[model samples]
Target chain A: AQSVTQLDSQVPVFEEAPVELRCNYSSSVSVYLFWYVQYPNQGLQLLLKYLSGSTLVKGINGFEAEFNKSQTSFHLRKPSVHISDTAEYFCAVSVPTGTASKLTFGTGTRLQVTL
Target chain B: EPEVTQTPSHQVTQMGQEVILRCVPISNHLYFYWYRQILGQKVEFLVSFYNNEISEKSEIFDDQFSVERPDGSNFTLKIRSTKLEDSAMYFCASSEAVRSYEQYFGPGTRLTVT
Candidate 1:
């Protein structure tokens, strides 16, 4: 089984400020990582994913995340945030079983971008 | 871009009553999934469907929970007897393939059991 841990539950930042949401995972086998954003009353939207290749992955909305295999971390970062960026961010790990796969998600970090 | 869609944005039902949440996954997707998020909690996997049968399911998916792909476009999750704990936002997702592919999500249907 695989699990994800989001270090922070809530993070508040002023508009245009940089922010990072920390995530770590535990799995016995290789895994794929992903970050998703959810607005109030909406479903999750993929921010980015780390399947393989470059450790640094860029996503939509100017967000990026770096996969640190040694540290078992995939932290999401945004150089500058806007009021519209206020949303809940989730970190997830996908573990392949046979030909199928299942996703395990973190508790989520609520990003509140203030003016 | 193609996207997954769900019906009955909100549903309120009494405990012990049956509830069915509907979803229409992106056309041509081969794998479908159902997930739920309780208030103030992380999203949890409920079940995964492929080739008209369930391929995987979580421990939370008990005897009361069932899934069906009755039609080419519709995938439904049925809770035989709703419990207060079943009140949550249920999301439907689909992927072209499960291996390292992105899953498109629906807007979700909020199920409220009272």
Candidate 2:
């Protein structure tokens, strides 16, 4: 079984300020980590994923996340944020089964990037 | 550039009535999925389908909930009887193939059981 925990329910930051959203997972086996962002009335968009290889992965919109195995964390970070970056971010985990894996998502963190 | 699409952005139904949600996956995708999120809750997986059959389903997918891929492009989810608890945003998604965990999601249909 896999589960994701997002400690922060809401994060507020001013424009051009850096931000980090924390995520942790619990699993008995290796799992794939993913970060998704949802805008108002929009669907979940894949922001980034950690399948294999490098622990630090860069994603769209100048966002990045580092997979810390020892800590069981995959925290998302951005050097600076814009007002447009205000959205709800989710962390998910799943074990790849050679087919579509059922995802377990976190409660989500609402990023309120204000000017 | 293909994307998943869903119909009936918002629906209002009385309790005990049946409601059907529709989805059209990417033309080339081979995997389809259904997920839902209550107003402020985390998104929960309902079921996953492939090759015209269900591959996996969560416990929430009970006897009252059923899924079908009747046509090449259309996938549908039907709830036998609606309850207030069933009100949520239902999202449809599709992925290309095996190991392609990146599923493209639709705008979602807001089912409101009144």
For lDDT, the strongest prediction is 2
DockQ of all predictions against the true structure, Cα-based: 0.64, 0.84
Q: Candidate 1 clashing pairs?
A: none
RMSD of each: 1.2, 0.7
Taking chain B only, the TM-score of every model is: 0.96, 0.97
Q: Which regions of candidate 2 fall more than 4 Å away from where they truly are?
A: none
Across residues A50-113, which tens digit of lDDT does each residue of candidate 1 receive?
A: 9889999999999999999999999999999999999999999997554446678999999999
- TM-score, cand. 2 vs. native: 0.99
TM per candidate: 0.97, 0.99
Error of 2 at A57 (Å): 0.5
lDDT for position B4 in model 2: 89
User: What's the distance in Å from true for residue A105, model 2?
Assistant: 0.1
